[model samples]
Target: MAGSVNQQQAVIYCRVSGAKQVREGDGLASQETRCREYAKYKGYCVLDVFTDDMTGKAASRPGMQSMLGYLHMNASKGSEIVVIIDDISRLARGLTAHLELRQSLAGAGGKLESPSIEFGEDSDSVLVENLLASVAQHQREKNGEQTSNRMKGRMMNGYSVFCAPVGYRYEKTAGHGKLLVRDEPAASIIRKAMEGFASGRFETMAEVKRYLESQPAFPNIDGSIRQQVVTDLFSRVLYAGYIEHEPWGITRRKGHHEALVSLETFERIQARKAERNLAPARTDINADFPLRGAVACADCDAPMTSCWSKSATGKRYPYFWCQTKTCGMYRKSIRAEKIDAAFAEVMHALSPAKGLVGLVKTMLHDAWGQRLAQANTIKETTKRDIAQLDKQLDGLLDRVVESDNPTVLW
Candidate 1:
């Protein structure tokens, strides 16, 4: 039995909550080292190391799942497996997760060993581990509640509890959160949008979208301006210089960030929105056009909007016309029937020749094979670069600290 236990395979599990915790020097690395030492003392062969830089409120961690899967795969081979952790809290922050993991490991004929605690298949040891886990969970909940209450008190005292909105930025003064106005190109577009609504230049939300898309200063997160973002910008009261926590319907005092538009301008924009909402809906006959915004007017470069009209004789005709009124070209509305025919003709022209198609397929297959080889080479190079950068950063920091000059040290 002692020989069998000595030949068992094991895996080390280490976790830290944040990258800052890892940098503090007594974290994941330290945990891994301690677990390795523990495994050596127990005479078990260490198979792998799994590290997760995440909170242990639950056990749905990637590293934890991989370790468990490895154990299950080796269980039927008569291979005994052990999971080693630095402490119980490192395994989980709550009792439920602890109890569930304990049962799971036991069911798989595996064991969990921690530097601070040991859990086995015995009833007495399991009871003690559960009790300790419960105490740790209770303390965690209490600390979380206290921190939330403190934050609430700070917010009520006119301190911002969250980061500043997109148009504004946070200014940390004496380690306290404060709001500051930052003028960005997006600010000009926001101001223009408000002005357009105020002066009746934009009649509806769609009109506002078109106007915004034409502006050079519009904000885009990833090369696309989503419709929801436009709607939120027009509806938010914060841009008008007032702050409201909508969940509680509580309006606070005016924010410290500079207002993008005057209150009067904002009010006028709201009035226009109300007017547009109350107006009777006009018939839009060309609503079925799929490429409505994709096509552009050849004369003025504005998007070509499709529309349909019914004559007195009950015949409906669809047409695409230019949007810009300033364009001097007098090309009449092109019939939708004619445009469809032209598109079909272009598609027919692109039908590949039989010989050309075969050659192109062969070329594509060869190119793909070369691309896979190149990708593998690049991946290996990137791994080496990352390892070198990590070592370089560590050495540079050490050298900087050893400098004699106080200014450089600071």
Candidate 2:
């Protein structure tokens, strides 16, 4: 029984903040050495080491969670596990998180040990350990608050406080914290997308996505062009002359950076987006052509529906004809075969008329441009009307107060 108990081992958990910490000072290796020495002195064989280079304010860390899972799995099998950290702060910086981890470790029938602090079944030892943990938590909170204040100060001074957005690279400046601007290939693609959208070459966001996916320069992340990226690129105000840090709120800060496109162009793109949202939906006609909801008969104004019949050779045939009997139109069902052939003949005939084709294209383009202009005009008119209504409302209220008429004011 004693030999079996001796076989139980300890696991060392080490962590550091970033790559710089690991490269410059006492990091994973140093922590491991200390933990191993402590375990040896405590008469426990070191089994494994779990390290995480992330903030300990959260317990959802990969290494920490994995270690907990390992402890739970080994707990009931007569395997006594001791989780050793360099200190309690290495486990978690937050008091709540530290307490939660302690409860979890205790519940799992595992013990947490640190060289700096000792724990025992006795009340005095437990109290001392808890006090040390609380002190560590306080230190962590102070450090976090200091760091946050520094970051906020930097942001207020027109310095970026976080990572640069895609298509832009961050350069650290002496006086300014970080400067951001367009990066190669990505910048070119962004410019192209903006120009394409502005020039009406790309009619919809989907068309823009398709164009981006086709280019070797605009490679998709994770082998697919995400719809969100395209939408974000189009809507991002940073690309234009203005910068909006927080959208949909009053806490927006205008960034101090060079604009990639004009403010007018940006507004136009936003208007296009608004127009698309307001556009009437179109229905597919090819699949349901003969159905009442699909095609409208030119003469009778009734829907053309499809029907099946048998030929003399016992072969199946389909035809579309007018449903209204009282209407002065062809009563006999039009064979699908003859209609398809005639449609093809008409299309072929039209294909040869270059002048007509050019006229149709020009008319369609002009119609689209006119529609956009009309939409803009309507929007401007609506804004003016709203402003006028607000003025009238304020004046009416003022008059009501001056007249001392409670009913009129209400």
**TM-score winner:** 2
TM-scores for the candidates: 0.58, 0.59
By summed lDDT, the worst window of 10 consecutive residues in model 1 runs over 276-285
**How many clashes (backbone N, Cα, C below 3 Å) per candidate?**
0, 0
Q: Mind giving the per-residue lDDT tens digits that candidate 2 earns over 1-410?
A: 13245565778899876667877877899999999889778788776789888877776688888888888877764555889999778888776787788888877757888897776879898787677767877887888889877866655555556666656778766766577766545665677677666644454677677677766545586556998888988887777745444532224355666566777777777876764321112232234333323444678765555556789999988677765666676555777777677777876886556588789899999977855765665567669989999999999878987886567755
Alpha carbon lDDT of residue 120, candidate 1? 61
Could you give me the TM-score of model 2 versus the true structure? 0.59
Model 2: runs farther than 4 Å from truth? 1-8, 17-26, 73-79, 121-124, 138-142, 247-254, 277-410
CA lDDT, candidate 2, residue 4: 43
RMSD of each: 18.1, 23.7
Query: How far in Å is the alpha carbon of 259 misplaced in model 2?
Result: 2.8
State in Å the error of residue 348, model 2.
31
Q: What are the clashing pairs of model 2?
A: none
